[model samples]
Target: MHTGDLAVMRKDAYIEIVGRIKDVIIRGGENIYPREIEEFLYAHPKIAEVQVVGVPHERYREKVLAGVIPRDQADPLTLEELRAFCEGRLAHYEIPSRLRILASFPMTVSGRVRKIELREEPARER
Candidate 1:
């Protein structure tokens, strides 16, 4: 069924729903899954929480952006550091092109991250 859910069938015959079709980021003809990137970024010691979203880009149509909550407010994560950390770890296109340090992610009443709000945020705030 084409339910707009991105899933994978494991060798054990279990289906894993990774993300949604609408959430996929297409950059330079490459498909990037925010959930995959978010999972990888969760390993970063400096990152307490992270959300990956696609934003407008003239060249690629869309570009990867990361919203992160630093583990320590005193020592926030930097874009350079994030890129460096992603190097050799994630694909070139999968690396976040922009980084935003958010105090808290906009959430729904159900407690889900509001990605739509993130996409609508002003460039200055991002």
Candidate 2:
């Protein structure tokens, strides 16, 4: 049973699924889970939806990239603003370094987000 899910066992034998192994981002030797970051970003009032992915980095192995769909298209979110929101909340290394405002994410026929498409897009640096 190889479900790609990464989980942890608690003292009570309860299983907690943190994220998927394929989506883990290794930045500067740090393991960053995109699912955790996505959960945190959902707290933002302006963000309607978000997908986090890793992009190649020259120095670090990879960097976090967030593709967001804002609740209000007229008022777009900024990288600095997102950083400010994440500051102190999430680990500094886990914060998204790049941001892409997308109207809608690429989805499969099953209605699942196609993160592979997002990873293929050119990352925009702030």
Candidate 3:
């Protein structure tokens, strides 16, 4: 099933899968929700879809990161704007430390998002 469908089914069953069990980042004692960040990005008109993941951090143990796909290919949103948008909707700790804009997400044969691969894609070059 699609993520949205699964989410609705889970809600109906009263089972809340807070985050991808494997994607939750423990940074400085905080539990960061990557979905929250992705949802915030989805609110923007320019964004088509988003995915957020956790990556290892040298100091804080782990850090939040985001990958975005734009609805309009020519007018992609910037990382700073995306971060600012997220800041308005999320707690400080939930904001992503790194952001990337992609043309499309990698998907499985059945069309499920390949989140494991997403989590492993190298961070955008600074």
Candidate 4:
């Protein structure tokens, strides 16, 4: 289905997706919604698609991470910009601490974005 179709489906459901079942980030005291950050990133004109995941965090138990696909080839949106956009739209704890840009998302044969696969990818070694 098209992006518009997916958007409509999500809207009709009245719930924002929070990554796959295993990817939720539980910070020191709150449950963060990664899809909230992803939706905020979609508001940017240059972004084509976005995904958010939870990765290990030394202080908070887990931190939010964003994976983005930009529409423009020359200048991808910066992590700072994505963070600022999300910060403006979401609770401070929901903002992503790490951001990655990809040319396209990995999808299933049926054209569904496979969030589980994204969540399984190894995080940056710190």
Worst 10-residue lDDT window for candidate 1 reads 117-126
| Winning candidate number (lDDT) | 1
lDDT for residue 54 in candidate 1, whole number 0-100: 93
Q: Where in model 3 is the C-alpha error above 4 Å?
A: 1-15, 123-126
Evaluated against the true structure, the overall lDDT of model 2 is 0.93
Ranking by TM-score: 2, 1, 3, 4
Tens-place lDDT digits, model 3, residues 5-118: 112246357765556656667888997767656767688888889888877777787788787888888888887877787775788788877777799889999997887777
- Assess candidate 3 and give its lDDT: 0.74
Give the range of the ten consecutive residues with the poorest summed lDDT in model 4.
1-10
lDDT of 2 by residue, 16-91 (tens): 8989999999999999999989999999989999999999888998899999999999998999999999999999
Give each model's whole-structure lDDT.
0.93, 0.93, 0.74, 0.72
Task: Give the TM-score (vs. native) of candidate 1.
Answer: 0.92
Model 3: colliding residue pairs: none
Model 3 poorest 10 in a row by lDDT: 2-11
Candidate 4 lDDT by residue in tens digits, 46-118: 7888888777777898777777888987899887887767665788888877777888878999997776666
Instruction: Provide the clash count, candidate 4.
Output: 0
Per-prediction TM-score: 0.92, 0.93, 0.77, 0.72
Model 1 over residues 1-126: C-alpha lDDT tens digits? 579999999999999989899999999999999999999999999999999999988889889999999999999999999999999989999999999899999999999999998887844454
